[model samples]
Target: MILPKNNYLKARNFILTNARMIERRLFEFHFENGTSEGVFHAVYAYRNSDGGFGHGMEPDTASPESQPLFGIMALETLDEVGYLTKEIILKDFMPYFKSITTEKGGIPWMFRPKSEYPCEEHFKTVKEWAAISTTAPLLGILEKYEIDIPWMKKAEQFVWSEFERIKEKHVFCYLCVSRWLTFLEHTKSQDKAKKTINNLKNWISNNGIICEDKTDEGWGLYGKPHGLNYAPSTKSILFSLFSKMTMESDIKELISRQKDDGRWDTWYGISEGTKLEWAGIQTLWVLKVLNNYGRIQY
Candidate 1:
């Protein structure tokens, strides 16, 4: 499958002209065949004095205050650009993570977002949001990058125990379930991982995640198409639901959705600043997903 040519180029040029530096670097690395080290360094600018990423690296938080939730975001970016390391993980971040570790050993989704940070009230005051989303991905990163930290080992225990507990827990959020499944993939087991994967698939299918809206209304809070846009993409939901047959059509529609400006737009929170950053991120994410799906021939 091929990405739209003129639209993609216009979008590319738009990104070059209007996107943030970090986003420009990501586009260069992913689409222009540029070095990932550029992304590596650009992301580092977001790194706080305490080692955790801040300065709005993830865009929504927009604070210099370091947070472990951003640690998950940072590690994801690090892995994408080939820069994950214990030195990177331990120097400032791990200590901060240790500081925030709950008595039960789980991390918080975020420590308060800075008062000046521009986002939803929910994000601003999401006190003690479940760490499952952060913890699962962080544990997966630690495992995939082979950081070998004791806290990570403990974190793994938390992940497993939490997942087991949540099995009985009702009304799971798609974000947490998605991350939990992600961690399970990186976690230490073939049989258990496979079992969890199947269960996630069944759960998603049973829960009606497949959006039936088929209209503009389906694009939820973030302008993402359908029921839940939080779990990476529709392709991901398809994977969990065992709906491989629809992937080709989904990819085609995704390609068609590329706007004439060459960017995929996301209607995020109130701030223009936040929207711009999120838009840049959406463009990079789209390119990455297309590449992963083997649709971009270049």
Candidate 2:
């Protein structure tokens, strides 16, 4: 595949710079500006504070602590930093994985205790969302550690079962499909992964451009349906890149959308009436995908 040349070198340099920033933060653990403690600290704080992870808010940001679903993003950031390790993976991170799952094998979007007020909306009984979102990261972490979590295996089974349940209706969001594909990739289930990608591609092709919402069809933010679409975080871009589903025309269009500064605004999540910044991390992520696919050029 021929890679686009525009800002390739600049993007690479930018990623290197950010990687250094991450390194410094990890070492210092108290960077004055920007997110503190790198991925390790973020994961530790998020799990301890919120009981689950999402995008919005930092672990150490403020009071009434909530877990940012972006914990998965943090892990992705750690992977970019080359800081992902078995010890850190198992000890500090995996515990959060356990909390998100219920006895019936359901995983919620957020996982604070029942006593938490507004935070309660974060809960969900949907096995599909739980397995796709939670288990994907769990699987990714396990693959990183080369150690298996039995619960994760059950989670995978649960996800596949739920996926089969919904495959006919095609009710899943593209983001869910993308994450499911990611989990399948980690588990080395190429056939199942490819099937999911084909289904997503079919949906996107027939449904017009995937925008943040059903209203705008042009490159939906993150996945389909409007409310969930957050343009700034590069969730859509990363998902496309990782799934290897981008058509040449689509990729060129995405390239055209790149800001002059070589960054894109992507949303992680919202917390305490605030959105988290994840562009730098997202940029590095996309660049890594392009590099691996031999799609990066100077």
> lDDT values of the candidates?
0.67, 0.49
Residue range 1-298, candidate 2, lDDT tens digits: 4445767655544444543344335423312233433645644443444344443333212334344245565665566456777876676566765765666464644444333333323342312335456556557557656777676667667777766766634323644554554565566666886786566555554554344232243343444432112112334433443233434434544455555666543554345222222455455545544544455664
Off by over 4 Å in 1: 168-178, 217-241
Residue range 187-279, candidate 1, lDDT tens digits: 776587777677666655566555544456324323223332333444563354434555565666667677767777777636887777777
Error of 1 at 94 (Å): 1.8
Residue 54 lDDT in candidate 1: 72
Candidate number of the best lDDT: 1
Looking at model 1, which ten-residue stretch has the lowest summed lDDT? 220-229
Steric clash pairs (candidate 1):
11-262
